[model samples]
Target: MDTSASPLSQEDFEEIARAAARTNESVRLEFLDGKIREKAVPDGYHGRIIEWLTKVCLQARPELWLYGDQGLHVEAYRRGNARPDGCLARSGAFEGAGEWASTEDVEMVVEVTSRDRDTNQRDRVDKSAAYAAAAIPVYLLVDRGNQSVKVHSEPEGGRYAKVNEVAFGKSVSLPEPVGFELDTAPLLGWVG
Candidate 1:
């Protein structure tokens, strides 16, 4: 392969992602504009956090449904397809949808920061931009690096207006739709 020679075309990038996904069920691919990124295979602690968060949301509101690693279609950017760690949407949000749900159908997007610093920042920075650009309403970031949770909301001009944060042991209140306090205690022991 010619190193640093040419940029990958959209079709080529999508194909590469497709091929990787075919063989690895754990692979979650994201296409932002013309850039492609893959999510790291989560550890047991990460899985537990995802499950716990989902359970909390669902248990509080039986009418809503939370999906793990659900595809989000961001029409604000070209070739934008994000697979969020957890996607909480109103019931029947994906009833007639394909593999992805449009931003309008989403209530909140959850991301559990990985062990890698770069990966964690990507979730906090890159993914934050993508979701805000789509006006997806809410972006919840669970930071394992600092054992804290950040909730970003009020999207405008490719950014979020409000950012609320709290330590792992504290409870963070989620806005409407998922109106409830998220207990972060269970996530404390898994912090990096």
Candidate 2:
């Protein structure tokens, strides 16, 4: 898919959508929409980690929003939407009415990868460029398959300077945008 096409005017795309829907009954349409759709899955270790992280974030700083499994569009980039496993952002960054976020309005984005063996690249590669392009300040990735928590900061021109990684028992400090340290102990312990 081309990820660089300039956005078409709303009218132009709506016409196309209407025509396509007229012929196809199986197509579910979503465009510039802010609704989220997630597959149901058993609550596993990854989910537990996210839950713990969310609690820690709230306890440490209750004013920020803690979001999970929701789409965010940061820039006008024509890339596939990104859904962070868990995230923290201040309130009122975007249209404050729905389950999705305008990527441009987010400050921190986190992704927790499960045991989907073949789809891990979606976290490491695709989201890396997409988040950087959106200029999101911090990106925290929890890779259960690898037993690591990778942190990316200082995004410059569609990339982040690879900085820190916390394994099962370690913790890392995020100083910019927010002041909180995440201890990986709870996360690692949740694994088993």
Candidate 3:
């Protein structure tokens, strides 16, 4: 079905997204790189991973909160909308901000891979690029598919200039704005 004359247009996508949000509570919709896609409803393992990460982030930086399923306006010029698994920012950063908040105050965005065919393109590639283009300080990808954690930082020219990947049992440090080291050993249990 032709959703719009130009499906890539943000205006058209937002209209459709609003309608979808009203009609469907079972799935989340995202607009990235000119395509609208459904984000998988996270499973139990996904919830555990996010819970663990939230605890870790809070313990390390009490001033910031890891908000789950926070909608954000991503990509250059805020042309795309994404509901990341977690959004870390100073507490109340999004207070009073309606759905699809700007990325300005977001210190980091996290995506824990879902057990679905779209995980690779949706999480590892598309979301990473969208977050970088929005100039978000850090993008943390808990990649269950590869049994690894990928940290994307130092955005430049609509892409991350630095990427660090470590196996689930290893420790990885999130950069400056999101200064913290994650002991990914706990992650191993959350992934199949």
What is the full ranking by lDDT, best candidate first? 3, 1, 2
Give candidate 2 regions above 4 Å deviation: 1-42, 92-99
Q: Tens digits of per-residue lDDT for model 1 on 1-192?
A: 221345555456557767887998777677764467777788988898888887898889878887887777775865477888888887788876766667787889999988765575478888898898998888999988878899998889989999999999998998765688888888878874
**Top lDDT prediction, candidate number:** 3
Question: Scored by Cα lDDT, where does model 3 land?
Answer: 0.89
- Kindly report which residue pairs in candidate 3 clash with one another: none
Clashes of each: 0, 3, 0
State, as a TM-score between 0 and 1, how close model 1 is to the true structure: 0.88
CA lDDT scores, all candidates in order: 0.80, 0.64, 0.89
Cα distance off (Å), candidate 3, residue 170: 0.7
Cα lDDT, model 3, residue 58: 96
Candidate 2 vs candidate 3: the lDDT winner is 3
Q: 77, model 2: CA deviation in Å?
A: 4.2
Per-residue CA lDDT of model 3 for 62-159, tens digit only, reads 99999998899885834788999999999999998877899999999999999889888989888988999999999999999899999999998889
Candidate 1, which segments miss by more than 4 Å at Cα? 1-13
Which has the greatest TM-score?
3
Q: What is the lDDT of residue 132 in candidate 2?
A: 76
